[model samples]
Target: MINGVTQLEILDFSHNRISNDGAIALAKLISWHKSLQELKLCNNYIGSLGIEGISFALARSPALAHLDLRLNSYVGDEGGIFLCSALSQNTKLKSLFLAACGLGSKAGKFVGEMFKVNSTLLEMDLSNNDLTEESGELLNQGLIKNFKLQKLDLRMTNVSQAWEFAINEQLARNIANSTRNNINSNSQPNMKTIEES
Candidate 1:
């Protein structure tokens, strides 16, 4: 059904029953179409195997910058690792939502690794998952290395309130630093005035 159409920038198939096979097809389409910028397949039945293809496609996609796979419970820790490992190399994606994907402390380790290398991602949501104290600690450690992330939501998850608070504070600091950097970059000295002087 998605063959005739081409050059789609945004494709949202949220709240559907797209399972593993469907996700593979979608991954093929994502790879075939280079202009696709945003893909939302939240609330589906996609699992770890399905996510492997998607992760591979997105790792190489040049235009895809936003992705949402929330509520896909089958995409547990293994799938989460597949995504994080592949996306760590991605430089275009800025926003990601993976809430309620049954992610745990193991996935948290991969996420920490992802944050260490990924500099383009600005916003991410991993709320309502199985992230526990261990995961929270790992997440904190990862955020310490990341300076570009501006927003991260871990609400309704197993993460403690204290950890979540600390993460949010770190994100706020990143935003402030980014704003300061932009201002400094934009404020160019007037060479003409200096020359006149």
Candidate 2:
């Protein structure tokens, strides 16, 4: 099916019975069409090996933005770590949904670190997984440093309202602080100009 297609942009093969071979076949298409933007392969049998191929494709496609690999059966901590490695390099990606993909405790930490340098990502959905308090804490610290994240969904896990509130408050403060700095800088410059005049 992939052989005949030329200009495929958004391919959603989620909830299917595909395996590594299917994922590899799709991965090969990235080389042909670098303009592909979104790729969703949720609820499939794409395990670590398949994700490896997908990661290769993602590394090559600079324009690809949104990638949804939720509910992949073999997606565990190791798989999540592997996937995050590729996602860290994808600077143009705005939304990444890996909900219910079985990202365990260890993988969640790595995913949190992935957000450190990946500032272009706007929305991330890590709900319905096994994220613990430790993982949430890591993410909380990460959120404090990440200035670009707009929405983060960590529902159905070990995260509490308190943690969420703390993170959101920190984000709000960061924005307020930046605004104050900008205002101060502008006022100082204007005052100096007025004094000279």
Q: Which candidate has the top score in TM-score?
A: 1
How displaced is residue 48 in candidate 2, in Å?
1.5
Residue clash pairs of candidate 2: none
lDDT of 1 by residue, 95-179 (tens): 9999999888889889978998899999999998887888887888899999999998888778888888888888999999999
- lDDT (0 to 1) per candidate: 0.88, 0.78
Separate clash counts for every candidate: 0, 0
Best lDDT among the predictions, by candidate number = 1
Worst 10 residues of 1 by lDDT: 1-10
**RMSD of model 1 against the true structure:** 2.5
